[model samples]
Target: MLLTLDLNDQRPLHEQVAGAIRRAIAEGSYAPGDRLPPARDLADALGINANTVLRALRELRDEGVLEFRRGRGVSVASLVEGRLAIVLRLRELLEEAGRYGYSREDLIEMLKELP
Candidate 1:
């Protein structure tokens, strides 16, 4: 998986990383049980601190999008539950956008502008 970070983005680096991974999971790029790059390796590739990547991964884990095993490292969570988790997250985002007076179109447009 390729994670690109934008330094100018108002979102924090950890959020960006987690968002990219979440998008990848939603798009079926990384299927259930697919192993993700190690935090250190991903950090090096993105030219950021390993802690940032770990923070992102931990967030995903908390959200049920990814799972980290003692010896197996991180992998996409179960397909059945992962999609459900993603859908719920999307719903939360939409509600948040609504609170900010952003329409569905506005949210889609913003997503389209992301790398």
Candidate 2:
């Protein structure tokens, strides 16, 4: 429920919302099978339009990070642990790589060479 958005972020509002939700899930704040706040509530909390939040939620669903249920609303995907772990680690890796002068493009190139 504690989603933060940077006023200076250049990403679309929906992407920023999705990123905040992803971080929340990665940090164990919202566990697998947990229901997220409704889009209107999230919109109010994040000061974004409800449609934007809904769009983000839909994207998360498509990414397998979240599940949409007719009566249950939106919940974290039951099998998201493995995926979330990778996502969280990837973020950390990218941040550390930044400090070491490795651009994301550089990391992508390295990964492309993996066996």
List TM-score per model, in order: 0.74, 0.83
> How far is 79's C-alpha from truth in model 1 (Å)?
3.9
Off by over 4 Å in 1: 80-115
lDDT: worst 10-residue window of model 2: 83-92
Candidate 1 CA-lDDT value: 0.86
lDDT of 1 by residue, 30-94 (tens): 88889998999999999999999999999889877788899999998885364656665887799
Highest lDDT: which candidate? 2
Best-fitting candidate, measured by TM-score? Answer: 2
> Could you tell me the lDDT of residue 104 within candidate 2?
97
Root-mean-square deviation of Cα positions for candidate 1 versus the true structure, in angstroms: 7.8
Model 2 residue 97 distance off true place after TM-score fit, in angstroms: 6.8
Report how far residue 78 has shifted in candidate 1, in Å.
0.6
